[model samples]
Target: MTRPIAGWLSDMDGVLVHENQALPGAAEFIRALRDHGRPFLILTNNSIYTPRDLRARLSATGLDVPEDAIWTSALATAQFLTDQEPGGSAYVIGEAGLTTALDEAGYTLTAAEPDFVVLGETRTYSFEAITQAIRLIQGGARFIATNPDVTGPSADGDLPATGAVAAMITAATRREPYFVGKPNPMMIRSALNRIDAHSETTVMVGDRMDTDVVSGIEAGLRTFLVLTGSTRREDIARFPFRPSEIVDSIADLVDRVGTPA
Candidate 1:
C-alpha cells in the first residue's frame, strides 16, 4: 500500500501555468490543497523573479499561490550559501530575484575578491557582466549558479538561461559552477526542509523528467509527471528513471490531494 501524501511540491511553469496562461485544472488543484489544509509549495527553477513577484504573476494567471508558498532557485541558492558560508560576500550576475535573495540572506554583494561568483537568470545577459564573472572566477572566487536549466520558455521561443551562461563562464575560467536548484536534489531537500515535511510523506509534481522527477527521486519523494508541460509521453523512455505516477495534468490529481496514493 502507498502512503498518504501529507505534503506537496509542484513546479510552476509546465505544471501550473505557461506563458501568462494557467494550464488545465491548475486552479482546482491549488484549491484542493487549500481545502485539505495541506502544506504545499509551488517550485520553480527560474531565478529571475522574487517569490512576491512570482506570486503576483501567478495571481494574474488566476492561480492564487501565496508568496510564502512559492519557492524559487534564487531562494534555494541563497539558502545553500547560507549553510555553506554564512555572511559571505558574492558578485552576482542576475536580476532582482538572485540579488535580493543574497542580500536578505545577509550576504554582501561586491566585485572585489568576492567569495563566490553567483549566476542566475536575467532577461538580458550582458557581455560585460559575463566578462567580469569570468575574471572573478579566475581570481579564486568559487562559481555558483542558481539552476542548471539551459533554456527557459518564452512566448517568442526558448531563451538561454543560467546553465548556458554557466557553461560560458566554465569554458573561460575552467571552473564548473555548483548548481543549487532542481536536478541537484539539494534544492528539493531544502524545499522539504522549508515545509517541515518528511520526504516519505510528500509528493513532487512536475512536468520535466530530467530536473523534477530526478530531483524528487533523489530527495526520496514520490514523483508525478504532468503532461501539461515541457515533457511528453515519449520522453519518459529516454530517461533512466521514471516518475511514481503519470497524470494528464494537474486536474487528474485534484481528488487525491490529501489521499493515499
Candidate 2:
C-alpha cells in the first residue's frame, strides 16, 4: 500500500501554467490543496522574480498562489549561501530577484574581494557583467549560480540563462559554479525543510524529468511527471530513473490528493 500524500510541491511552469495561461486543471488542483488544508508550494527554477512578483504574475494568469507559497531558485541560492557562510559578501550579477533575496539573507553585495561571485537569471545579461564576474572568480571568489538551466524560452526564441553565462565564467576562470536550483536535490531538501514535511508523505509534481523528477527522487519524495511541459511520455525511456507516477497534467491528480497512490 502506498503512503498517503500529506504535502505537495509542484513546478510552476509546465505543470501549472505555461507562458501566461494556466494549464488545464491546474487551478483546480491548487484549489483542492487549499480546500483540504494541505501544505503545498509552487517551485520555479527562474531566479529573475521574487515570490511576491511571482504571485502577482500567477494572479494575472488566473492562478491564485499565495506569495509565501512560491519558492524560487534565488531564494534557494541565498539560503544555501547562508548555510555555507553566514553574513558572507558576494559579487552579484542579476536583477532585483537575486539581489533582494541575498540582501534579506544578510549577504552584502560587493565587488572587491567578495566571498562569492553569484550568478542568476536576468532578462538582459550584460557582457560587462560577465566580464566582471570572470575577473572576480579569477580573483579568488568562489562561483555560485542560482540554477543550471542553460537556456530559457522566450516569445522570440531561446535565450541564454544563468547556466550558459556560468559556463562562460568557468571557461575563463576555470572554476565551475555550484548550482543551487532544481536537479541539485539540495533545493528540494531546503523546500521540504521549510515546510516541515517528511519526504515519505510528500509528493513532488513536475513537468521535467531531468530537473524536477530527478531532484524529487533523490530527496526521497514520491515523484510525479506531467506531460504538459518540456517532457513527453516517450522521453521517459531516455532517462535512467523514472517518476513514481505519471499523469497527463495537474488536472488528473486533483481527486487523488487526499488518497494514497
Candidate 3:
C-alpha cells in the first residue's frame, strides 16, 4: 500500500474559491480536513488581506475556515525576513497583512535607512509609496516583494499586481526585487513547518502548474492539480513538469482526504 497523506497545503483562489465564490466541493473538502483532524493550510499569494480578514471572507462564502488555517504571502515574507534579519526595519508598501506580519515578527516599519523595502498587494497602488520604494532601493535598501504574480483577477478584469509594480520600481532603481512567494518553494516549506508536516507525507493542491505544482515538487511534496481553477488539462503539455495527480476539482479530492493509500 502507498503512504497516506497526513497533511495538506492548498492554494486559495483557484482551489477553494473563484472571484469570491466557493468552488465546487471546496466547503466539503475543508470540512473533511477539519473533521478528520488533518493538518492543512489554505495558501494564497495575495498579500492584501490578513488571515482574520480571509477567514471572514471565506465565512461569507459559507466555508468554515479558521484564521490560522489560512496562510498568506505576507506571512511567508515576514517569516523570511525574521529568519534573514531578525527585528530588522523595513520601508513597506502594502496593506495590514504585510505590516501586521512584520510587526508580529518584531520588525519595525520605518522609512529611515531601513533594512529592506518590502512590497505587497494593496487595493490601491500609491505613486508616492512607489517613489519612496524606488528611492530606498537606490539608497541601498534591499528590495523584496511578497509574490511575482504580474496580474490579479478582478470582477472587471486583470488588475496589475505586485510583479507589475515591482517591474516599474526595478526600471527606476535598476534592482530586481526578490519575490518570496510561490515558485520559490520557501513559502511551501514554511507552511509545512507551521503545521509540523513532513514533506514525504504531505500533499500540495493547487490550480496552476507554474506556481503550485512547481513549488510543491521543489518542496518535495506530492502535488495535485485541479481543473476547477487555472491550468486546464490541455495546458499541462506546455509545462516541463507535471503534477502527481490531476483531478476535475476539489470535489474529487474530498473523499481522498485521510484515506490510507
- Top candidate (lDDT): 3
Q: Ten-residue segment with the worst summed lDDT in candidate 3?
A: 252-261
Off by over 4 Å in 3: none
> Which pairs of residues clash in candidate 2, taking residues 3 or more apart in a chain or in different chains?
none
lDDT for residue 141 in candidate 1, whole number 0-100: 98
TM-scores of the candidates are 0.98, 0.98, 0.98
Please give me the total number of clashing residue pairs in predicted model 2.
0
Model 1 pairs in collision: none
Model 1, residue 63: C-alpha shift (Å): 0.8
lDDT of 2 by residue, 1-261 (tens): 678899999999999999889999988988888888888989999999999999999999888889889889999999999999999999999988999999999999999899999999998888998999898888899999999999999999999998998998899999999999999999899899888888999989999999999999999999999999999999999999999989998999999875655
Please state the error at residue 253 of candidate 1 in Å: 0.7
Report lDDT per candidate. Answer: 0.94, 0.93, 0.94
Candidate 3 or 2, higher lDDT: 3
Error of 2 at 131 (Å): 1.3
| Model 3 pairs in collision | none
TM-score of 1: 0.98
